[model samples]
Target: MTSASLGMAHTSSQAAILDVIRAAGTISRVELTRATGLTGATISTVVRRLINEGLVLEVGRAESTGGKPRMLLQLDPTARFAIGVHLDHAGITYVVSNLGGAIVTRWRQPGAGSDSPAEVVARIVREIGGMIARTGIDRSRVLGLGVVSPGPITAAVGMVLTPPSMESWTEYPLAEALEDGVGVPVLLDNDATASAVGEYWAGGIEPTSAFAALYMGTGIGAGVLVNGTVYRGASSNSGEIGHICVDIDGPPCWCGSRGCVEILAGPAAVVTAARAAGLDVGPAERSVAESFAAVARAALRGEPTAAAILQRSARYLAVAAHTLANIMDLDLVVLTGPSFALAGSLYLPAVEDLLSTAFFARQSHPVRVTISTNASDSAAVGAAALVLQSELAPRQSGARLQAELGPEPVPAQGRTSVVGSLG
Candidate 1:
C-alpha cells in the first residue's frame, strides 16, 4: 500500500480506538488492544498520539496480573467539549458535554415563540459563550455544536422544513444560520434521531441493539436504530411517526394530513380530549405543555377522564409502535423527550401491554417498551452526543455530510474561530 493509504488507515484505526476507550470509560492498553483487535504496537502508537492531542489521560495504575501494574487510560473529559441545542416551539434546551458525553452544563430557555429565527441564533451564540465561560473550558478545545430541531428536515441542506408544530421555522436554514453566528460547524437532525443517539451514548443499550426512540415533544417522531446506527431514511426524516395515519377519520394535523398520530394522540390532542371530557385543564390559553402536565397530574391522581384521555393517546401510539416494531423487528422501544418526563408511566404500560400481547412478532419474541432512563434532558444530551459521535465515531452516526458538501461558509461579523468541522 502507498504511504498515504497507510496513514489514512492508521487515522481510521485511531478513531476506532478512541471510540472504544470512550465506551470502556477507563481501560488499559492491553484491554484496548483486545477490544480493537489491533496489534500492541499499533495500540501504543495510537495511545501516544491521543495523549499528545490531549484527548486521552493516563490515570492511576490497574492491578497487575503478574508483572508491574498496568497503566489505566481514559478519555480526558476536559480535553474537548461539545454543545447541544434542542430548539422547540415552547422552549430550548442547551447542554454542554465533554468527549465522554457527560453533561457539564445544561440550560433551558424560552422557545421560538419568544423570538424570531435570527434572534434565536444570536441568543444561542451568546448563551454558548456564557456556558463555556462558566465551565472554564478553553475555546479551542470546544469541538462544535449539534442542533436538534423538529424535523421533516432536509438533512443534506441542513434545512428544517415545515415541521408539524413549529410552522414559524418553515424552510429555515437553521444549521447554516447557527454555524455562521457561532462559527462552529453545526449538525442538524430531528429530535427523534438525537434522542436515539443519546440512548446509544448513555450505554444502557448494547452496541448491536436494535431499538426505536419515540420522542414526544410538542410533536412526536421516532428514531429507528438498527445495529447501533440510526436508520435515517432518505431526506433524514425517517422518524416522523406523528404523521403516520392512525385514524383515517381523525382530526386534521398541521402537516396537512387527517388522522395523523400527531393530530389524534399528540400532547395537543390529549389536552383537547381532557378538556372535552369536562376535565378542568386550566384555562384554554394555557400552553399545550402546561395543559398536558395538568392532565398527566390528574391522571396520576386517578382522574378517570384524564386517565382515559391518555389511554386513548397511548392506544394510538401502540398502533404506531406495532407498525415500527414489525418494520424494524426492534428489541426495545424507548419513549424519550421532555413531554414523557411527566406522563411516561401512563404511556409505557399501555404500549408495552399492547406490543407484548399483540405485536406482530409476539409469537416469536417480546418487544420491550420502556421510557428513556435519561428522560430529564435526553434531546440536549443527544445533541451533545451527536458532536462526540461525529468527531470520534463519525461512521456510527453517518456524519460524513461535511466531506460531501464541504465546510459551511462562515459569515463575517462576530465571526469566531471554527472548531473542528462536524457538518
Candidate 2:
C-alpha cells in the first residue's frame, strides 16, 4: 500500500479506537480489541500511541477475568481543552471544556449587537485568552475554538450567511477571523447541530440510532443525529425547523414563508402573542431571553391570556416535532436553548402528547420528547463538543466532510428548503 493510504488508515483506526474508549468510560485493551474488531497487537500499538500523545491514560487495574488483571484505560479528561462560543444578537456565551466535554470555565457577555466583524473577532480572542489564564490551562494544550451562530452558514467558507436574527453579520468570515485572531483552529457550525453533538457528549444521548435536538432561542432549529453524528444537509444548514410551514395561510415569516414555526411558535412569536393579549413583556429594547422569560412567567402564574399564547406556541412546536418524527423516524427529540429555560415546562408535555398521538409510527415505535435540563448553556457546551467531535470523530456528513475530502474545497450554497436554518 501507498504511504499516504497507510497514514490515513492508521489515523482512522486510532480515532475509532479512541471514540470507543470514550464511549465505554473505562475499558481494557482486551475489551477494545473485542469492540473494534481489531487484533490484540493492533490495539496495543494504537493504545500506546494514544497514551504517548496524552490523549489516553491508564487509570487502574480491572477485575481479573482469568489471567493477570488487565489495566483499565480511559481518556485523560484534562489532557486537552476546547472553547465554544455562542454568538447571538442577545448575548454571547463562552464555554471551555476538557477533552471529556467537562466545563472547566465559562463566560457570558453581550453579543455583537452592531459591532463590526473585526470588533467581534477581537473580543473573542481576548476572552479566549482570559479563559485559559483563569482556568490555568496551558495555551498549547487547547485544541481549537468552535463558534456556534445562527446559521444559513457556508461552513466550508467558514462564513455566517445572512441569518435574519443577526442582520449585521451577513456573510461574515467568522471562523477565519477567529482562527487568525486566536491563533488556534476554529470551527463554525450552526447552534442546533452543535447542540445535538453536545447532547450526545455531555447530555448522555450517545449510542442512539436517531434523535433530534430542537434548539429554541429567539428562533428555532433542529439538529438531526443519525447514528451518533449530525445530519448536516447540502449546505451545512439542514435543521431549520423554524421555517417549516405549519399553517398554510397563518402568519408571514421574515424568511418569506407563511406560518413558519418561527413566526408561529418561536420566542418572538410567543412574546408577540403575549403582547397582543395585553401582557407586560417589558420594553422592545430588552433582550429576547428576558422577554421570553416574562411571557413564560406570566403563563406559569396562570394568566389566562399569556397561558393561551404559550399553549398556541406549544401546539405549533408540536407540529414541528410531529413533522420531524414522521420524516426522520427519530427516536428522541430534545427541546433545548435559552428560550426553553423558562417555557420548557409548558412545551414538554404538549409536544410529547402530540408525538405520542400523531406520529406516523407511533404504534410501532414511540417517540420520546424531553426538555434539556441545561437549556441555558447547551449550545455553548455543544460548541465545545463540536471541537471534540471534529478532532476525534471528524463527522463524515455535512459540507465540512465534503470540504475536507471532496474533489474541490470550495463553499457551496446548497439550500434544502424555502429558507436555510436559523441557528
Judged by TM-score, which candidate is best? 2
Off by over 4 Å in 1: 1-11, 155-160, 403-423
TM-score of each model, in listed order:
0.90, 0.91
- Model 2 lDDT per residue over 1-423, tens place: 222332233236676677678778899998887776777888899899889888899999988878999999999998888898998888899999988888888889988887877888798789888878888988777777778887676544544455565776777667667766787766677888888889887746645458999999788999888766667765667888889998889878877789898887888878777778778999978777788899899889998888888898898888888898899999899999998877898999889999988899988988888888778888899888877766765434521333444432122322121011100
TM-score of 2: 0.91
Error of 2 at 305 (Å): 1.9
**Model 1: worst 10 consecutive residues (lDDT sum):** 408-417
Candidate 1's C-alpha lDDT? Answer: 0.77
lDDT of 1 by residue, 1-423 (tens): 222322233227776677678778899998877776777898899899888888899999998788989899998887888898988877889999888888888999887774667887888888888888888888777788888887666534444456544666776677767776776767777778889988887777765668999999878888887765668765667878889997788777777889998889999989888888888889976778888989999999998888888988988888888888888898899998877888999999888888888788778878888888777588889988877876776553354344333332121122332334322
Residue range with the least summed lDDT across 10 consecutive positions in model 2: 414-423
Error of 1 at 119 (Å): 2.0
Candidate 2: stretches off by over 4 Å: 1-11, 156-161, 398-402, 406-423
